[model samples]
Target: MDRRKFLSATGLGAVALGAASTSVGAAPKTAAPAAKGGPAKFKLGCQSAPFDDEHFAFFARYGVRNCSSSAKILDPGRIYPTVDELKTLTDMGDRHGVSVDMVDSVLLTSSHIDREKNPAIMLAQDPQRDRDIEAFQTLIRNCAAAGIPAVKYNMSILGVLRSGKVKGRGDSEYLAWNLAEAKPPTPLTRAGVVDADRFWERITYFLDRVAPVAKEYKVKIACHPQDPGVPPSGYQGVDRVLGTIDGLKKFITINENPYHGLNFCQGTVSEDLRDPGTEIFDVIRYFGNRKKIFNVHFRNIKGHRDNFAEVFPDEGDVNFLEAIKVYKEVGYDGMLMPDHVPEVPGKPEARLENFAFAYGYIRGLIQAADHLA
Candidate 1:
């Protein structure tokens, strides 16, 4: 089916979809908006993939006041959430004094292309694309109803590609990705190879449909960059966009809606370019200045693009102190969370322990930056 027919049939056309507004009647119960002069104090948070009550307790214990949880918390088996389910989840967070600020999970079903599906449709393809868009719209509405501020998503068809684990500072295992060790790229769809242009077009199509809904709901849409790194060609199976600074600029400009921004993965950005330290600072300055950074995956890495080892925030190549300063200069007042950490052997609470360490380190940076300011 052609684009026009597809949109028409799916009721995605501007007028038709616009008429069926998804805004909820009641506003979510949450904190007051920060005053409009200088930057507001930012919150430190974490993602609980398999979100549960225990996760909240952990966050509360560590004095983490924000959370980015999996959409699975709402419908364990599906990607979408009903209003009631969203309310229940948010209420759970509230009880522990932690705010459910964002929700994320795998929006795409498969990592690689399946020959059984039409390449054209599968790439930007039909029913699935339509359903995904609707699911995202519903998610935005539900987030608004529950007072969640953002939805983080990734557009990469290839997903994350990691090679092996590498040893880190404290004899911990960190997931490493080296392009040399990476598997060869395969066709993303049965039709053949997907190009950068096509990948971006699909992304634009998604944003066009969803951004308006997000705006109406007052929920920000934050796109995650292609993880590991975006290859000169594509990585592991498809062309990756939004991996570099240029790509990120393209992404933010694609939709003019203020609600369209980034989840801002610091480690991924550091890994995407040749000079991570310099480039990462520039990225934060550029996006943060525009207030397009809705949240942050505040982690660090050992190397640059195509080959890197994940590391704790303090031990990486990037100067996170400068990172905090940049965020401050850009007036970013969003949640910053440690995206990844090493898994120490023989440690039952390795993740939590790593998080606690990261929390302390980042908190120190924020405080130090404030003092300098």
Candidate 2:
């Protein structure tokens, strides 16, 4: 969809009714605006995927306060917008009341490997790497130039994928989970087999090169865990860094810094069949106060690996109420981007609709809790 048409079609009307109008009631009470100083009022947002500038503009106009960028949207190859084009995006953000909350780099999993093998993937690896870690450096530069404060990166071996068998269920309920399957039936590169250690080294190397850059720009690098809690198999050729809780802690220990943080994805942690409250609270209690939690990907999931289904935030096993309470208690002022949403019916515009729904739901929850508190 073109920008103007798309914006007009799905713009502020969704939430503006409440935002722009005053309530008529017994006392005619007005909702308080989000407070500042003590803590930045937490906000609901979505990833910049299923791409459309208007879709994002709609979210912004509707009250979305933050965004997690996708590689599809930001990389030089895709949008390929010039410096002028980027200025246009910044102008668009200004016009729409949106801020680039977090700039996401390539998944340190498959995308990272791709970079190591293919020169094209070499984002700023000189000879092998780019001149200065090109893609990440570019992202940080754009964010800094745009006045964006943080950027999140992942360190999983494989990020998100569900089998056709699962997705084909269509009407039936199913959970997206990781398979304990091996990857790469045959060698794709000159290296005999890309193993776990090599992947970890490359990741560290990437971080070592890029973390300083992020620091220079004041962006936070949030490393997400490998979902499903499974290490890469021998036959799989794929490898993971943060496949387990211990792995996450270990990774933190290795790269200790306030700037190097975690993206606590509740659904991925729940895939371990553990209580989401415990997992989320533990991370926040440990990291949030330190400003080590760069952001969050909030969604509810049911069941364990090979048997998980995406559900509405309140419908799943995770305790979002407690999660939010913990978030507030810990002063988690970072962006809370909705991770996944079941496709809505008759909504051909999957990206914007889902994000709109999520934003509304989370906003209601947070406001309700704030009122009670």
Candidate 3:
């Protein structure tokens, strides 16, 4: 295709060339989506990605660029990372050709509610939750001051759940979840017996406090969904409000700020439904069209809700090529990285090797999507 036709066909014709400093000390400009009216470019990014030199070398070896870091250079627990400290992280990534575009929240992530440091925020405890929320707000201010665009987080009380593992292609172990076979060490967690009413109440309380701060800082606070959907009767003696599609739909509307959105885990959301292959597209469109998806965990599954296995990108129930096209169709401009990968053994760098496959697979899909007629 000619340049003009290619641009028009792929919806890149009006994409304004936007640049933001992604490193410390008057760093070089990186081209990205404009603040407004530009086409949203789908960046291939990794989440919970490495930050150290050796790990950075691994990612750079495969040409990975933008990603959310699990780095503690600017930790929320110690002190609010000064703008300089935040820039220090970006500078480190710059040395390895990666950009630390987002950072995971220190106090609130996927940790079990009982094990959480910021439990007050999710537990509806007064004053203390307010203190915890203040720290997050401070982190947001530092992030914006340092030119970082987003902060990814989770409000998960139960964290992730899986029943067992099933052998997949090439003898890989796919993370499986079968409700019938599911077993918890105990009937309830310390958070105990939260109904949907109470769950929503806690969720809103956190949002009502944090959403305004996020908007003011222009930092996107991304929330991940509950791992696998549980029954209305509840699991582990707790109700997970973010586990269902209906619940997730209601979640983004609470404070209705631009910064409060989802981390959009495709794999987990796939595990939430009966038929992920067919049901996922509309869900993608619903969130994507609303411009609420901050980052995407572009992994896949092999079966439906309550009976599934987390599989590789290519050999899953969802047509990832189609999913990528839908992301393009809806102008999702963030990183699409793998969140969960099947454990396929026998490689020297077994874990990184699996991740490498996902990164390459994603790049391949993006290339195909870019040229498809």
Candidate 4:
């Protein structure tokens, strides 16, 4: 099937839910939109920076042009001058010749797990939900004021776990059957997990409330696909969100908003597609330029169904050549990060080395492609 047709088949029709009506302050007209240029030389970035902004100065030093960062640094509750602090960080990045391409939402992923354990953190639940909403709204407003372009949020509710301690590998951090301990081959149900209906209601409400403000502030909201390619058991009370290709399609189709986009994690979807290199072109052809794809995680796995390992970005089952070619063909200008690399041996900093290797390799691919052009 073609990319457009594939997406259409997977997309679920949905309506915007109780979206907030508040307006985000006007974006300054002086800030220019991203220029249409040839492919950018990709770079290596971490979801969380181990050190201060200074640690990432190496990106600019190496001519690595973009950095994908966590939105945590801009939290007003934790720190002050939140918006200016972010802009200053970005400005420093520009000074070093590195640009902040995307600000990933922290509230849902790791933060969600933390909230799950400490129910008080969940803003969507009861009295806390209202306060959480207000706090999050303030965050969005802060990001807008900082001139941050996009914020990606995930909808995974209960955390997935497999029972047992995972063994660590020298090449990577730790490859486990499940991040959480749980029985395998269990029956799956949408149940109380982040269901399609609940996701639509929450996301639509968020987008409707935030999209216009984001537009006014010149920022975009990108949602990531549910990881693991399956729903956590409803009976077990495990949470799952956007676990399939169809789930992702439902997210975009439901809102039917251009501002709504995706964080296309190749590894997660590869669990479903089996051959990552094969259907990727279709995804790009369909979601590309349509403005649905905002960021990409370039990782690979060994097996297709129910089992896999995170391998070196260069040596994975996914054909990087075809993937890069498809990305270029579709004019994808979004950030492509070498995600979840195997840890190197004994250095204690193997991830950084793996990231550098992937970054260099992808850059060479782009350069080679550009030469052919």
lDDT by residue (tens digit), candidate 4, 1-373: 2233322432211211111111112321221223334643333444436424665675655446777665436545552236876687677667767777667543555333434532323224666554555555555677778776777766665443322322233334434333223364434422334444565666666555566665566676777665565443332344344655555666676546666678777776665443444554565556775768878887775434234455666655577666766666667767777776666446767666666777787677667656444
TM-score for each model: 0.82, 0.72, 0.86, 0.75
Considering lDDT, which of the candidate structures 3 and 4 is the better prediction for this target? 3
lDDT of 2 by residue, 1-373 (tens): 2223322432311211111111111231122223222433577776656335675677676678567654335444442233444555555556667666665554343343443333322232345455435656776767677666776656543445453223312343333543432244344433335466776676677777777777777767777766655434522355444555545655665556666778877676565433343444454455566666777878876544333556667666566766776677667777777876766445556645555667787887677657545
Task: Write down the lDDT of every candidate, Cα atoms only.
Answer: 0.70, 0.55, 0.76, 0.55
Query: Which of candidates 1 and 4 reaches a greater TM-score?
Result: 1
User: What is the lDDT for 104 in model 3?
Assistant: 78
* Native-referenced Cα lDDT, model 4: 0.55
Worst 10 residues of 4 by lDDT: 12-21
Can you write out model 1's per-residue Cα lDDT over 85-179, one digit (the tens) per residue? 77777888889998888887346422444523222223676877787678778888888887788888777655566777765565687787766
Per-residue lDDT of 300 in model 3: 88
The best-first sequence of candidates by lDDT reads 3, 1, 2, 4
lDDT of 1 at 344: 89
| Residue 261 displacement (Å), model 1 | 0.5
As for TM-score, the candidate ahead, 1 or 3, is 3
Candidate 4, residue 79: the lDDT equals: 24
